[model samples]
Target: MENANVLIVFVSAILLFCIAFSRLITKAGIPVLVFFIFAGMIMGSEGAGGIYFDNASAASSIGNFALCYIIFAGGMATSWKSAREVLLPGALLSTAGVMITAILVGVAAHFLLGLTLMQGLLLGSVVSCTDAASVFSILRSNNMNLKAPLAPLLELESSSNDPAAYMLTITIISLMKSDGGGFFGYALMFVMQLAVGAGLGFAFGFAGALLINRIRLNSDGLYPVVAATIASFVFAAVQLMRGNGLLGVYIAAMVMGNVKLVHKTSLVRFFDGFSWLMQILVFVTLGLLVFPSQLRAVWLPALVMSAALMFLIRPAAVFITLSGFKYPLKAKLFVSWVGLRGASSIVFATYALTEGIQNADTIFNMVFFISLTSVIIQGSMLTPVASMLGQLDKEDKTLVSRSFTDYEEDIQGTLYELRVVRGSKAVGMAVSDMKFPESVRIMLIKRGESTIAPTGKTLIKEGDTLMVTTGKTEALLALKERLALV
Candidate 1:
């Protein structure tokens, strides 16, 4: 027990260092998630740290929790206005499209590697869903514009596909382990899982929101904390009822995020950071759970499966499902390329490991390798590749931007004051001329706090709080780099 604290501290320190390093390399477009996991591998039992952790149960639970945070955030970030146009196609893709991808990959795996149909499908199902965190983060970060409903379609696709893939994976694993099970039984199980999960998630999410709306806490911060509990409870309740709790959580959060609620910005910020933390932990811990030595044995088969997935299976799946859709070749190509296997794949591997399935260790290691390769290769190139495919461009600002009124947002901005100093470069320059990096918006310079509005002609003075709206980091950086201000 005494050494436990020491181990925790050591692991935590490694995580912090990896996170810092990841941030430093964002310019290279490699996601921070990839870095966190790789750092875990370097510190694992096979590596220098000599930490042997084969606790499949523990890893699975953590992975599930991490996925919940991710799904909730994805839902919150989605806009109803944008989501409406994509709903029809999105549903079709999540249900029908996911099945198609799984089948194609399964077929390829069977033919190429001579694996059984079920085994092929399991591998296919594992990587079918586009990673929710990776998709949302990259799309928003690059400000990639989709053709009208197409953006929302992809967002919804990524958000909802997890449930179906997860169902298939679990059911197949069960059937494999069972003495016997007919086709009708398998179908019934799948339908039951989907219906139950959706029903429970909706009920819990709606009820939670109703309860939360009435609770006027002393502090506004309580709202987010309450919502966090709501998310977890909604997921747990659904899972306990033999439903797809993961899917339920996402739908519930999407509804909540779109509701007319107070403190929206604060809520978004809270979830964004929370989801990031979850992703870091999920990826890193999953990495440590893998043993590198067994990986060599699985190398041949894993690579065979990967090639079929990357080239043959994914493209076939995309083409079949998108048959009637108006998506261009570029969008289709980009979509096929970005079908990453991240947290969910790792979780599925955990499932395989825990069930005492055949070759579980080898499968886990193989998956860990594939996930690393996919995220680093596909994840790092998402922006560039999308840009090349004409699906994304650097000139775009953001898909989601907030509009501010003269009073409301401005009044809020004044609370975070910005000042123009005497002899400051901004003094003589026209508000537009100085080219402020969208950080500070000049509101009003006060000779005193009584309220004096600054017009376009307003001059600057030292020791005056400029009453400008600015991004915290941006404002500080601007002051240091451009104005030499403290």
Candidate 2:
């Protein structure tokens, strides 16, 4: 009981400190996640706090649990309408681009770090994907608005590319354990994981949406609980079937996000906050798992590898994979620069340590350094780089803000007040009966200074001033037509 209490207090302190410190450093242009990691390191056994924690299996379990929700939240937040425009490019970037980057990094690691081919490949695979959390944090935090399609492309690629890197890592581990045999068998396994994960994801997503919309739970809060349960089941079932659970969870989320469900606003908000908690936990846990002294031995090699990844391998992969597309050179260059490896890479590295692979310690340390460097350097420079490349959108609108289902709130679109004229068609009609477009929302209504919190059943009245908000000009125009104000 004493130990448990101490544990709780320690964790709460770290969380509170990280939260407060992150806000203070936002203007410094450093990624807030870097502080979460530093807090863990500062509290580790080697640092001032003297809390000893060195269990790889525990870290791996916690990291996987956190990553599952992080991926799910990302999927739920994605807008299908926006994603559709860049699907093909995103697909190629996530798959072929990952493969190219991994292979190049693997070759470089073999030559530069004196590791065997398979071991080098394993190292490469661990850092292959651009982290969704890191990319989303940087883009959203900077209030970045890239030209059309580029922002969506980057989001889709980061969110969906994890499976490829994961499969490659697992496959390489299997080969190393089996003395580099069974190449064909592992390739077949890789393909099967993706196919099964994708199929089951779509099936579960639609079913979950239908259940949420029809169940009509007694409490609004229960709706988010149900959605979380469905996500858990989807991930567990896919993993049990030998499919990639991360891919399954993400696909399921994307499906549910696009479909209509009850209490969607609350659902999105719940997962958004929950995902942040998970990220903090994952980064801090990873930070606690490492020893700063051990990193010294691998620092030079890790630095070399980080440089190669940031400058050469990532750009090559982006350009090679995106060559056929009609994107501007500046856009492609910006995309390549925004390839920030973060929590996901560090989490993936824990897999190697748990599996007891050769040089696991070295691999883990190198990956940690690489991820830290990427986030600090690339993450901080995203805004300036985009501006230099001429990719920043001058318009106030941002792709990150509009990427969610509840985008009107994020966009903070124009608000209009129009008094209901006597005998207007909208008069005496319920707000629900107005049939406002999904993009438009009635904020409130005022009649004779008696403010009304408008509900679906709230009736419009003569001389009532309606406060309306919407992000879409077309939706606003349509609402005007419906109210006979145009």
The C-alpha RMSD of each candidate to the native structure, in angstroms, is: 7.6, 8.0
lDDT, candidates in the order shown: 0.72, 0.86
Candidate 2: which stretches are off by over 4 Å?
1-7, 396-399, 403-486
Candidate 2: minimum summed lDDT over ten consecutive residues — where?
Answer: 402-411
Candidate 2: the clashing residue pairs are none
- Please, what are the lDDT tens digits per residue for candidate 1 over residues 1-486? 878888788888888887667645554555667777777777789987778877999999999888888888777776766677667767777888788877887787778767788777777777777777666655554445544444666677787788888888898788888888576798897899889988877777677777777888999879999999988988888888888888899888877776656666577778989999898888888878877777788788787777667777677777777878887888788778867767778788788888888766766776777766776677678777776877753333224221000111223332355565566666555444555554566555555534445444345556566555655665656654586443
Model 2 TM-score is 0.85
Q: Which candidate is the best by lDDT?
A: 2
lDDT of 2: 0.86
Question: What shift in Å separates residue 118 of candidate 2 from its native position after superposition?
Answer: 0.6
Q: How displaced is residue 57 in candidate 2, in Å?
A: 0.7
The C-alpha local distance difference test score for the whole of candidate 1 amounts to 0.72
